[model samples]
Target: MGLTVVAGMLVVVGIDVTAVQLARTQLWDAADSAALDAADRVDEDRVYAEGLHERVPVARAGVAEIAGRHLAEERRPHLVRSWSLGSRTGSPDGESAVVEVVGRVDLPIVGGVAEAFGGGVTVTVVSRARSQVR
Candidate 1:
């Protein structure tokens, strides 16, 4: 009986950890995708003017929209808490842009084993990429 209880507890812990890791992974992937998309649209001619028009905010919004649509289609419920796009500043050779995305996903174990220890769980992911403008 003692061993059985221990095994069951271990299983529960494993499941919770796995869930959290998976959530974090998904967040990172989304961030990467968003960053790349925005970087690709960067306008180099008028770095200040055109770049502002094709800023990280615009890219972040686009990514969020696409991610939301994807989650909905997969029947997953996740909310984006915050999203930010870093500035476009570099040398004359080239420029790099950064996009940061943050999201919160409700885990299945939140009310069960997870709440027993503390509260719910929230995952944060950040990704950065550098691309040369034409």
Candidate 2:
């Protein structure tokens, strides 16, 4: 009986592990896609300064707005809890958009209890990407 119980527990934990990893991947996907979409619409028709520098023309408002729109569309049904925009900045690093996505993965069987106790593990993922200028 003890061995059977241990095996069953292991199986459950294993499934949880897989679910967690997939959630992480999905979070990354959401970030990447939103960043890409924001970058795409950032600025397609714009002129750059006359200088020897690597700089990107940024459309800050549109970038954040577009990113939020994409996140709203891409939010997963169960895995995602809530998501929001973080910061949109441009510097030597790059003209980037930072998207933060949060989700919860309830533990197998005990998910409800775990959440009730202290809330299930909340995963907050922040993704960043640079925009290109034309």
Whose lDDT is greatest here? 2
Q: In candidate 1, what are the lDDT values of residues 1-134, reduced to their tens digit?
A: 99999999788778767776776777677666655554555443455555543233233334434434433444232433333332321122234434454555455554455456654565656665555423
Reference-based TM-score, model 2: 0.71
lDDT of each: 0.50, 0.63
Error of 2 at 12 (Å): 1.2
User: How many residue-pair clashes does candidate 1 contain?
Assistant: 0
TM-scores, all models, native as reference: 0.57, 0.71
lDDT of 2 at 65: 78
Candidate with maximal TM-score:
2
The sequence of per-residue lDDT tens digits that candidate 2 reaches over residues 88-121 is 3222233566566666655555566677688556
